[model samples]
Target: MQVTLKNFTKTFDDTTVIDSMNLAVNDGEMLALLGPSGCGKSTTLFAICGIHRINGGQILFGDRDVSDVPSQKRNVGVVFQNYALYPHLTVFENIAFPLSVRGDSKPDIEREVRAIAALTHIEELLARRPAQLSGGQQQRVALARALVRKPDVLLLDEPLANLDAKLRLEMRSEIRRIQLETGITAILVTHDQVEAMSMCDRIAIMNKGEILQIATPTDMYRAPVNKFVAGFLGNPPIVMLEGRTSGDGRFLVKEGTSLPLPARLAGMPGDTPLSLGVRPEHFGAAGANRVEGTISFVEPQGRETLFDVTLDDGVVLRSIQPARDDVVFGQKVVWPLDAEKLLAFDVSGRAV
Candidate 1:
């Protein structure tokens, strides 16, 4: 199913939660709505599932408008954060519940339940109740139940948030596999950047009830539209520093630090106040066009070491290097900035 939201609007007592939000989940594509709490991601999901009514615009499943359809009639399967399984029901019974609700024959329900259980690898746990299952097991049961109905669309609301780190990783792969196998158009609402980037085909970055940018994981990382999108999508987060473009095609970082501006930015106005954004990995050993700084902190992260370096003007920046590199706190070091990889933003936060 290709689910489309056209000018979707949702409000509560004069407060708008989703303001003219428009998005589309392409057929069989797994899209993720990612943002912080109160960013309207969950609300947008609910609106699509008909749990929250929209104030304006249309909700289309393919070409048909289902904006006013009731939640139960939407044919959208939902797997919530808590699993929401019935504790008293066995896994088989729980998976069969959705089919049984619409008065399917006993034998047909049994056949569908078993098939879904097999697909989810929970066939052996058919007789077990929710309490007897581990968090991951319960999650699988929930997924099976959702798939048992063979919904055209699947909605996951932080479905793996309650699991442990290892379990979360496992479920991420599990969910992706199932979505691909079933070819269901799915939307996942999550705040975890890694989960979204790892699972979804495309990610919709949201903030303050509006979509900031929607793109493939690689594109969103390499070319964010603005400061918010750039800062929100990285693991350690992009380091941002105040700077200005000097008259001589140079980007001035601080009192005595500057690097030649890339030719692509030759048209930028001289003395333009800007924010310089760079990933930690973009800094390297001292060479041409490098700047000097004193290390303030060092953290060894298995394969890589993270260094907190402070410049002469009190500006601090982070750099990541191979763990084998000998680095010590309080020692002076120099690292060249990758001019081509540098991102520049105007005072308004728009990428320059």
Candidate 2:
């Protein structure tokens, strides 16, 4: 189903949860609503599911307006954080519960349940109860249950939150595969930037009941609309340094280290204060542009090393190297900062 949220708003005793939020999920595409807790990501999902009443605006499913529809009638499949499975019920029964509720026949339910179980690769565990299965297996059962209904929309509320790191990675791929294979429009609510970036076609970054930016993961990462979005989306996070334009129209980072402003940015109004941002991975020793700093810390991650450098002006920046080095802490290094990889944000936090 193609879902649309137009000027949607929700309130709890005059405190608005979702304020004039507008977003659309194309048919068969997975849209991830990503943000930290109390940022209104889950509230938006609940508002769409009719669990929370809207104070204003419309929610549409295709051409129909379902803003006032009851939750039971929306034909939306929900997979909750806890898996919400019946302890006594076996996998087969759990997968068939939705069909049985709609009065599907036993033979038909069996066929549908088997199909979904096979699709989720849980066919062998059909006879096992919830307690007998691992967390990932239980998660698959929950997914199968939600899919058995063949609902118009699918809503996943942190469905993989309970799994371990390895399982979470595994399930992320599995969920993406299922979405592609079934061609079902899905809304995924997650706080994990990695999961959202890896699995969804587009991600909406939310904070304090508002969406900061919406774009494909690459755009959101490579070209964030503002400082908040830029700082919030990355893994080790983007390193930001206080910088300003010199009288000569050159961009000088900390310690009066002036670099010629890009020709394109020379048109910007004079006396603009800019914050320089650099991603850890973007720093390379091969680049001509170099920043002088002493290694404050080194974090080894097997395949890569994260080096935190304290510049001459007390600014700390992080850079990623291919692997751990013999360089000790407090060692001085001339790290290359790619000028093209640098991002600038104005005083208002908007990208410049």
Candidate 3:
């Protein structure tokens, strides 16, 4: 199913939660709404599922208008964050609850529940109650229940948030596999960048009730439209160095630090304030642009280590590289910055 929102607006009392937003989720494609808390990710999901009445705009499921449809009549399935399950009901009974509510026959419900259980790899846990299963197992039961009805659109509300780190990694692949095998249109709402980047086909980055940018993970990472988009997508976050354009075709970092400006950015009006954004991986040992700094902070990340290098003028650049005993904290070292990979933003935070 293809889901679309045109001028999708929502309000709570007087404040608008979703401002005249427009987005199209392709047919059978998984899209994620990623942002910080209270960014309207959940509000948008509920509106699409008919749980919240929008203050304005329209929502369509393919060619049908579902804006006025009731929650139960939309034929959409939602797997919530907490994996809402009945403690008293057995796994089989929980999976069959939705079917039972619709008054389906005993045989029909049995076949559907068993088939979904097998798909979710939970057939063995059918006789057990929610309290008897692990977090991952309970999650599978929730997914099974949602899929048993063969819903047109499957909504996942941070479905992996309750699990441990290992389980979250395990279920990421599991959910992706099940979604592909079933070919159902899925919308995932998450604040975790790793979850959104790894699990979905495309991500719509939301902030303060507006869609900032929507693109594939690679595209968004390579070229963000603004400072916020560039800074929001990466882990450890993209480092933004404040600077200004100089007359000698260079960028002057605050207080006596300078870098040669690429020809493309050399003519952007003298003294124009600029921000240079560089991802952690882009700072390395060899490149055309170099800066000398001291390793001030060290964070060991298994095979790779994160180091904060405080350069001349006190500019700090975070670099992630292979584990090395050669570089110790407070030691001076010169690192290179990939000129072509650097991101430039103007005063308004718009990409230059």
Whole-model lDDT values for every prediction: 0.89, 0.88, 0.91
Q: Clash number for every model?
A: 0, 0, 0
Report model 1's TM-score to 2 decimal places: 0.97
Q: Locate the minimum summed-lDDT window of 10 residues in model 2.
A: 255-264
| lDDT tens per residue, model 2, 177-218 | 999999999999999999899999999999999989989999
TM-score of each: 0.97, 0.96, 0.98
Q: Determine the backbone clash count of candidate 1.
A: 0
| lDDT by residue (tens digit), candidate 3, 7-39 | 999999998889899999998899999999899
- Location of the lowest summed lDDT over 10 successive residues in candidate 3: 259-268
lDDT of 1 by residue, 1-352 (tens): 9999999999997998888889998999999999999999999999999999899989999998989989899899999999999998998999999999999999999899988988899989999899999999999999998888889899999999999999999999999999999999999999999999999999999999999999999999998989998898886778888888886778887555676676688677788998889788777643346878899989889998888888888877788888955778899987887777878888899887
